[model samples]
Target: MSAWQDDATRDLMGLGGRLALLVRGEGSAVWDADGNRYLDFLGGIAVNSLGHAHPTFVNAVSQQAAVLSHVSNYFATPQQLELAATLKRLAGTGEAGRVFFANSGTEANETAVKLARLHGNKVGKKGLVSLNHAFHGRSMGALSLTPKPLYQDAFRPLLPDVTYIDNTLEALDELDWSDVAAIFIEPIQGEAGVVEHPAGFLRRARELATENNALLIVDEVQTGMGRTGDWFAFQREGIVPDAMTLAKGIAGGFPLGALVTFGEASELFYPGTHNSTFGGNPLATAVGLAVVAEVENNDLLANVVTRGEQLRAAVTDLPLVTGTSGKGLLIGIHLDGPHAGAVREAAHRRGLIVNAPTDDIIRIAPAYTIGDAEVEEFTRLFAAALADVNGTASEENNA
Candidate 1:
């Protein structure tokens, strides 16, 4: 057995086995402990926006660590305030918005739930609505909105009154808006194999939420930070959510999450109602500020569009691939058969890293900094991997 497998403290909580012992990373590639290099198409499951070991990110974190790392919520740091302002500006809520920081996406969603419940308590609306096959987080509150039974059935009795609706307008139209406290939706459902909300679905959701006097919360944990060719996925839809949860690429892989609320929802949480010790530490926020600056200065959002198009164009025509889905760098490949796992394993053997979110779906969330050369290399390796898997399957059938 491998050393990681033999470790006593390692829990096999559904992650079956260790894939590789990655020692270091740079740009869109990582090297395993065995000294093998692989192009990281998974991008840490859409976390490393600017790619690994970005000099700007490294310098920001280092400088902040050398200056001030943590100060708790009692005393606010300049970096924290600056990050809050920057996020508010990016969210397009301007000076009227407020931000609450957290350590991860789940915590951000937890905060959103609290804010929704607080708003609901005031207005006597206690129900919540979420789309089916949506993945917010693993926390009890976020899991309540998440519709997958496999993630929730084990932990029964989640937060009550959460209704899971389909992605269509008809499903949303059927909901009695009077009782709903909030409607939580992911602009692009990442964990559901990159499934996108149908056209005009978000706009209708906004209208419904407004009609019911409920909050509209967009969980942009995966789709935010230029993953969809925009700062936030909702921007393309041209509707602003009342509150949005952000993480993943927000800090360019730093452990940071934020809940940004617009309009009156910004004042929902009282001073003592919610708190996080390590939420907006100077080091993390300093890195966050740097990431934001990097995204703008380097024009990573435009890069996301270019690279996404190049990748989709390269792969969509492959014999094994049925089609490609998603915007920007958060892409998914639909296979003609249930061979995503086989293809992923084959790609790994060929020094390419990808994710099989399902038996038939392969997710590719490469870094925004991925260049045309890297995309071409990935396409070549991926096609070879598909051929290898297909050849193996054909031999098995003949045997």
Candidate 2:
């Protein structure tokens, strides 16, 4: 391991140790201290929408920093307002929609949790619903919506009184809407091995939430910003969520997030209801605007669809590969055995970065700027990794 990796293991909190000590990156590749190049299929967990060191992102950061960086939320900046309008348009919120800025996706989801409370307060409801194995964020309120024991166990006595359900229409119908303030959906549960909901589940949830007067909040933090072949995965289902949370690729790897509310839900927050010191400041919003413009003008959505299809097709035939899940650049390769860990290590040895969210799933969320070269190279490295692991599955394995 490199010096940084040793320091990370000794000093970093929670993180056991570092993987490779990545020193620099450009496009879809990174280099470690030993000068070894690795194909970055993870893309900062879908944050590097434009890959690393893109001119647009760098320029935006530099220009905004040179001018003005941050001010209190008491004051609004041009970049902030423009980003709000852009998010409203992209999210189809129209005139009735409103935006709340934050510094991370968990903070955005926390805002959504509060919105659920505000909606439920008038109706005497104190319940929330989320799918099983969902990973919203690590904060208390957002952690409540995330129903994993591993994530919520130590932090027991979670708030929000959330009910966990499977990704089925029957499970959704079983939710006690009489006491439900909101139902949170991840659209595509990226953290849960790229699990996609059953067909039409989103639409049905929308109708049910409406009939029950519950807010339908989609956690688009992983699926939005054109990662799922569209601006948001809910659009593919043709459902208009009452609210949605965004981050992770919104600003091309910048630490920014947003909570967007629609219709009456937009009217929930008054002044002092919530605030963030570094939220929607000039620096973050300026970078976000640049990222959005690049994705839109270059038609990255189409590239996402095409490259995603290419990746799925290229890897589906590998040995020990059961199938794939997810859409667009966010994909999960399913394994027939509990050897995803072995395969991940093998991939890293071969200089291809991949993530295994479960024992049998390897998730890949590459940059939207990927071309045929990246797909082809990923297939070569990943196929070799699979073969190397399947031949000898007893090797020590970790991310």
lDDT of each: 0.92, 0.93
Instruction: Evaluate model 1: give its lDDT.
Output: 0.92
Q: What residue pairs clash in candidate 1, if any at all? A: none
Worst 10 residues of 2 by lDDT: 390-399
Regions of model 2 farther than 4 Å from truth: 394-399
lDDT (Cα, tens digit) per residue for candidate 1, span 1-399: 678656623665654556888999999999998899999999989999989999998999999999999999998999999999998888899677999999999999999999999999999989988889999999999999898988999999999898988999999899888799999999989998999878999999999899889999999999998899999999999998999999999999999999999999988999789999999999999999999999989898999999999999999888689998899999999998889999999999999999898889899999999897899899999999999988988898899
TM-score of 1: 0.97
Best by lDDT: 2
User: What's the true lDDT of residue 33 in model 1?
Assistant: 83
- For residues 1-399, could you state the per-residue lDDT of candidate 2 as single tens digits? 657866776788863436777899999999998899999999998999999999999999999999999998889999999999999999899899999999999999999999999989967888999899898999999998888887889998889478999999998888778899899999999888999889889999999999998999999999998999999889999889989999999999899999999899999898888999999999999999999999999999999999999999998889989899999999999999888888999999999999899999999999999999999999999999998987676444431
